[model samples]
Target: MTADDIARWFGEMDAELGGATLFLNETERQLVCSRKLFERRDVRYLDMRADFDQLSDRQVLDLTKPIPRVQSVPVMALMVAMYLGFKEIYLLGVDHDHFITGTYVYAFDLKAQRGKDDSVSSSGEILTSRHDDFQSLARLWRQYRVLREIAAANDVQILNATPGGVLDEFPRVDLDAALSGR
Candidate 1:
């Protein structure tokens, strides 16, 4: 998620959401910490370091050490969940379809009104494009596979509750059933 998404969530649903823990990179944590809403709310920010190396081998993420950067925030979130001892992790809205659509649009910002077009990096750099040029979407899939292996080894269950799009690394579950503990 982008800074705008975080801001919007806190801005619009601050009361309903209660509290949130944001796992952000150093730069992102600094940026988010500067926000007024975050300062007043019960929000905990964790720092993660950038790791450009692809997940070439199966490994478990050690949270006590520096958390390695993944292809996206959702993947990073999965690592966080595992580290937090969540045995049954249910993923919601983890659609990895940017490669298919060739855009960086998110499910919440489908109209492209809040993200992609006006997204600014944590380093205060203006990003005009909707997609990243460096990494291929395939790398994301590979990272998910690595996460799946890690989850299996740790005896954790990861169920993807997303409606559609890519990301077939984990078993799919119905969102409603998962939410209701069915």
Candidate 2:
């Protein structure tokens, strides 16, 4: 999700979940802080860049292992889960292939509509864009390869349960089969 999506979701989530934890990278933190959303009492902000464990080449990512630098926030989140010692990590909605169409599968559509209504869309496509950079998406695929090796070394099973997703680094399991243990 984009920074705007994070901010908007943070507000909406606050109403339903009551002060949920929100993860932010530097750019996202800047955007949220500038809007004064960073000061909210119901929200706990995690600076992903600063908070994750840094691993060296000899280190592994596990409950006691440090996380190596990754290309995306979702990867960092996975690392955190690994640090928490989850035996199986099932990934859903990881539609990495949408970069081919220059769109995100989980786009901030309602937010986009509001922006269009308020003329925010007219400012520039780049400013309101939710698409990942083409090169960055390619890099993300490479990062997933490394993550797969790391997960295996730690005896953690990373299953790609996203049907039709382009991520083929991990074993693909049908969502129903994964949930039913079939």
Candidate 3:
């Protein structure tokens, strides 16, 4: 999501999310901090630092420290969940197929009114803002493997509930079955 989108959502949902804590990476925090959303007394921001290329073999369970980044926000989020002591994490809509699909799409884009120039759209246009080179894409897969290792070491089960995708680092499960504890 863009900074404007985040600001607008916060403005609309500020009252309803009174006690929620928002976690953002340093870059994201900088993007939305100027909007004064952080001024809210009830809103707290956890500034997570990103480590772009390096993959740690062990789990980084400390929320106060920097988490290793795996080129995808979902990986970082999984790290946060593990840090928060979640034993099982079910990943949904993590297709990780931007290179194959040649476009960036968000799950909420169906509800958003986007313009032609919008970076995210349902039209499947290639995003010009950021391009992931072949090496970077390869690194993403390697990072996922490392993340799987870390999850195993921590005894955390990482399940991929995405219908079909290239993210095979974790075990695949049916979303309905996983949700119903089958």
Candidate 4:
């Protein structure tokens, strides 16, 4: 649902699926091109990349331009929340500090996978990972700010409930406070 790469999973699982398919961008690209050639009338695709010139001045973020590259999936999730008419959005565990430690939470065998083509970094070094470097980290924050503007344009509020996260763009609230409707 987030990108074209995952669309094939829907087709592969469509045989046992019962829900509607919602893809981003072109529906045909997301479907009918995979190995199974899946197609359904219930499938719907939403294209949020309206031309920057056509959008009102209030909608400041030009997602179509692809500038200030987004480093996290939460950006897309936030946009989807806006489309779904969510007025209050709270985030948790959306940390971008994995680079600070030069390791991923899932990379349990960083030593064994060092220098592998698919591994996070070359030379088997874990401390020099640049994925979370200053520029990349800053981009994540800038993208979140853009999401904040977009949310405001749609009369929505985004709160960062991520405990101790480096992200300081949005107002941070306690997770319990958010969940208790306080």
Q: What is the C-alpha RMSD of each candidate to the true structure, in Å?
A: 6.0, 6.1, 4.1, 6.5
Give the total clashing residue pairs for model 4: 0
The TM-scores, one per candidate, come to 0.66, 0.63, 0.71, 0.60
**Could you give me the TM-score of model 1 versus the true structure?**
0.66
Q: lDDT winner among the candidates?
A: 3
Between candidates 3 and 4, the one scoring higher on lDDT is: 3
**What tens-digit string does per-residue lDDT give for candidate 3 at 57-154?**
57645767665545777867887788788888999999977767777675553332355345445586765544544666677777677777878998
- What tens digits encode model 4's per-residue C-alpha lDDT throughout 6-49? 55444444655566454344535535455344456354444444
The residue-by-residue lDDT of candidate 1 on 100-173, one tens digit each, is 55455444423313433444443334454535533446577767877889889889999999898688999999
Q: Which regions of candidate 1 deviate over 4 angstroms?
A: 1-17, 32-37, 50-60, 101-105, 109-135, 176-182
After TM-score superposition, the amount by which residue 77's alpha carbon in candidate 2 deviates from its true location, in angstroms, is 2.2
Q: Per-residue CA lDDT of candidate 2, range 113-172, in tens?
A: 344332133332333234435556667776677677778887889998987868888898
148: Cα error in model 4, Å: 1.1
Clashing pairs in 1: none
- Candidate 4 regions exceeding 4 Å error are 1-32, 37-56, 60-70, 106-132
Q: Which ten residues in a row have the lowest lDDT in candidate 2?
A: 119-128
Give the CA lDDT, 0 to 100, for residue 49 in model 1: 67
Per-residue lDDT of 10 in model 1: 51
The prediction achieving the highest TM-score against the true structure is 3
Clashes of each: 0, 1, 0, 0
